[model samples]
Target: MKLQQLMSQTRRAIDDYGMIHTGDKIAIGISGGKDSLTLLYALHGLQRFYPEKFDLEAITVDLGNPDFDLSHIRHLCETMQIPYTVVKTEIAQIVFEERKEKNPCSLCAKMRKGALNDAVKKLGCNKIAYAHHKDDIVETMMMSLIYEGHFYSFPPITHLDRTNLTVIRPLMYVSEADVKGFCRKYQLPVVKSPCPADGYTKRQYVKDLLRKLNLENPGVKERMFSAIINGNISDWTPRIR
Candidate 1:
């Protein structure tokens, strides 16, 4: 897709969700992965001259990997002057040893989300944005349906009760391929997750499964994503738009 088309989709999501309000300080959760890095870059590109005045900062939850040199992130953040803070955690080790039987994905995501929320509160930001895109949304829907026998996926915008933080997914309309292509075009420094379960994980299996399913049924991802938006989610929340 053309860069203009990609930007248009991203812009639509941002506006549709009313994310990045004026005079707001937004913090992004960067996981050293393509999705996150792409998010950081896209936000940076938009922040250059966003009509609305706001500040952007990048935060990464370091799994405390000895091999992970965060200098790249530091450099990028410094270049953009976007306050980049790293929170060190032993969650990786804990998850591996303690949470072996249960699905580690749910726990890992919750912990990371807790950490991100804490960061938002610590930084005094009213909102937080994640890098989830079209593919992730579709895959999540598939995962939930196949395993939990339910139709559920991430929302484009949400407000948490405890912290009252607005979580927005700006790249919700963007594609994974476009993100990777944009990263390559911009030569964004790609950082690998220090998590030992990087490649050998059930999430990877689900990703592969989704891909195969899509290959068999063309437009499967597109239809699934659209269904989530236009489907009967009225019972899930009164805030359904």
Candidate 2:
């Protein structure tokens, strides 16, 4: 049931967003974390029987952290029979030194994504996928509304205006809990970000708050997800993927 839900949600997101087309090659960005790992698994499953066939390449952006390893990721990709590419980038040092801020989350994320996009393009993929899930969408909506003085969140599909490349978030409708469960069930080898910041950053703060709220009101995150998906802010348009 869990796997079905995960796959169903992902396929619906992909079909609804037109993320991939016949004969197109896509880059699935796997960070070796649970979310990205699950994304690869889901895509691998989809590739098994997708009528409109497409090629998928699993790519990981190595942050040049000493603790980072592509061995486990490589094995998983080989087990799934998908090719893997690792991009070497000094993102950790760059963000730590050049980003003179109390928190380097924003800059680090941007740099990592930019590096991944560039690498994917060079690797012959015009479409890229990220492993952002339901919780991420809700948290981003909350952050935008509370901090940015407006309501906004990541879209299911969009073209990076500057690069004219398409980005897809197939896990948009799936929950992070489901992802963790799926990873455990499959015994997927997981990797962690080896930095002091690790997963204890500001996003975790919001996630913790949401978790506590969920204890009292389990409907909170669901409501947030619905609002983001069903609510409209303005006439701001989106370019189709």
For candidate 1, write residues 1-241 as lDDT tens digits: 4456666777778876577678988889988887887777778778876677888878888765678788887899898789998988877777877666355666787888888889878998888888899988888887788888988887877778998888888899998888888777777788877666567665677889888988999988888888897785643332322
Which 10 consecutive positions of candidate 1 have the poorest summed lDDT? 232-241
Q: RMSD (Cα, Å) of candidate 2?
A: 2.4
CA-lDDT, candidates in order: 0.79, 0.83
Summarize candidate 2's per-residue lDDT along 1-241 as a digit string, tens digits.
Answer: 2667778888888887677688878899888889998998888888878777889999888888898877988987898899898999998888776665568787888988899889888888878998999999988877777678788887887688887688889899889888888988878889877766877776787788889998999698998888877786453234244
Residue pairs with clashing backbones, model 1 = none
Model 1: residues >4 Å from true position, as ranges? 1-6, 97-102, 235-241
TM-score of each: 0.89, 0.92
Name the candidate that leads on lDDT.
2
TM match of model 2 to true structure: 0.92
